[model samples]
Target: MAKQTPMMQQYLEIKAQYEDAFLFFRLGDFYELFFEDAKKAAHELEITLTSRGGTHDRIPMCGVPYHSVDQYIQQLIEKGYKIAICEQVEDPKEAKGVVKREVVKLITPGTVMEANLLNDKENNYLATVADFEDGSFGFGRTDLSTGESAVTLIEGDLNDVIYELASISAKEVVVSEAFASKYEDTLEQQLNLTVSVEEERELPESMEGLCSELEQSKLIETMAPLFHYLIKTQKRSLDHLQKVTYYSRNEYLKIDYHSKRNLELTETIREKKKQGSLYSILDKTETSMGARLLKKWLEQPLVDRKKITERHSVVQSLLDNFFIREELKDKLKEVYDLERLAGKVAYGNVNARELVMLRRSLHQAPSIRIM
Candidate 1:
């Protein structure tokens, strides 16, 4: 084998850390991929595969422009591939030797926050499962786009956990190394989920506030692995991450996985599409946030009579006053997805246009309240 160049050495070192993802190593204006990554990305992304001259042999290489890389990333993410965005951290003019490049972000299907990639009507949830010795499991889910987080204890077998995951339509699942080794195939084959492993289970003090309301240690244990994975991959302040909500399965109406599919509550049974689902039929929500909430309500129908009655009374009030209902609808139309906007703000990715939208959404609040 030929001796590797200084830049190639750096790329190899960084690539070793993220073996599973395609490393988009930064090279000036283009984000290049080398070796197997280059070949795979070239084929998957439909980009031209080229070669870089090495000392003895040619090395496979491919790249997409940095400015237009998001489109390519979106394509790979849709195909359930992870991408490690290696960016030049230091200026070439200021660097001592090769520019300091690092993996700035790891984009997975569940962790996608880009506006163009996300669907306004739905959430992208990253879930985590922790199996206990007694046969029960802890399940936690978070929507990075919406800052919504929740954890629940499943007092059933792996099938029960799989059912809950299916209901949420999770794109990816994080689990312990042991858990992954045991159930990774099942999760992947059954739900077609991207399974990630996070060995950390201890809850850090800084994130304690996020789960302060939860008294159960099992809930904390379940949420910790997810938190660790988010912190590791995101590498930023998760300020928008809401306090983790804890819920028991008994609180909501129980529906088996088969029944959920048969009823087509969220997606059709045969086609597995959302067009003819119950959610789609009943959805008259004007805003994206309302649409998401409506789906959640449908998926987990309230079993408690008090809660059910409260929701029914609210609906009755809206029906009683036609003008008020129409006015509220108009106001809601002016509102943006506040949950996701807040998430972008915390992620430091919110642009000026989104900020203006946020302002406009806030302006509708007073009108909504009056109506």
Candidate 2:
């Protein structure tokens, strides 16, 4: 290997830290990708593949303007690429050598919080499966967009996990190191999941005597590795994360793939799209969160007649008052997606426009109270 320039040396150092991700090395106004990253990105994005400073051995390179980089990121993520955004940490105007740059955030398809890159009506989930010695699977899933987290124990084989995950439609999955090594091919071939491996580790010793017996039992060994990976990559306190929802496999009605397809509950079997489906036809939601919650209700319909009647009573009350129902619907239209907005705020990514939207949504609360 030839000696690297000071700037290139800095790039290499940062690049070494995030080998799995495509490094978006910030240089002045452009985010540059060197060598293999450049080659792959150029090929995938169909952008100009060029080179940088070497007379005899030029390095492969590609770049996009920082202002227009989000679209490129969206494209890369759609192609199942993780991106490490290296930003200029120190101002170049006062830099002694090359302006110091660091990876600010790592963006993956499952962890994206950008409104433009995400579907408003759908939850983006990252799921994890841990194989147990007893042949059961400990499953964990979280939607970083909505801060919803759930875990369950599936008392069957990998096929059971695959079936559940397919229904959830998760963008990514993580598994224990042992599980990944053993079933990597099976998971990939069967579900076509972007599976990542995490080391198996015990929960912190300090928390051993901290909680009730129920909470302690709910703290499964599998959850630690997945949550650790998320914390490391996210590099922030996931304050928005909800309580770990431990559930039994039999809590909800089990709808198989064929049944979902035949019933056309959410998507048509032919087009595999939501248009003309039951959800689309019955979806009278005003906000993104409402749409998502409605979909969830449809997917997991309650079997308990008492709970069902409670929901029906609310609907019956509204149905009885036509004027009030009309007024409530109009008021709901004024509100925005509070759930996702709150998630973005907790993630420290909410902007001025989003704040204004939040205020507008809150303003509708008073009118809604009239119901």
Best by TM-score: 1
Candidate 2, residue 318: the lDDT equals 86
lDDT tens string, model 1, 100-123? 999999999889988899999988
Model number with the top lDDT: 1
RMSD of each: 1.5, 2.6
lDDT of 2 by residue, 1-371 (tens): 78898999999998998887899999989999999999999999999999988587889999999999999999988766789999999879899988888888888877888899999999888888877667777787888888877778888877788888887887778877777788878766766666776774655433233212325343466566667667767876577777667766675688887898899989999998999899999998888888998888888777778878998999899889999888888888879888788888888989999999999999999768756
Model 2 clash number: 0
For candidate 1, what is the lDDT?
0.91
Q: Which stretches of candidate 1 lie over 4 Å from their true place?
A: none
Clashing pairs in 2: none
Worst 10 residues of 2 by lDDT: 205-214
List lDDT for all candidates, in order: 0.91, 0.81
Against the true structure, candidate 1 reaches a TM-score of 0.96
Clashes of each: 0, 0
Error of 1 at 109 (Å): 1.4
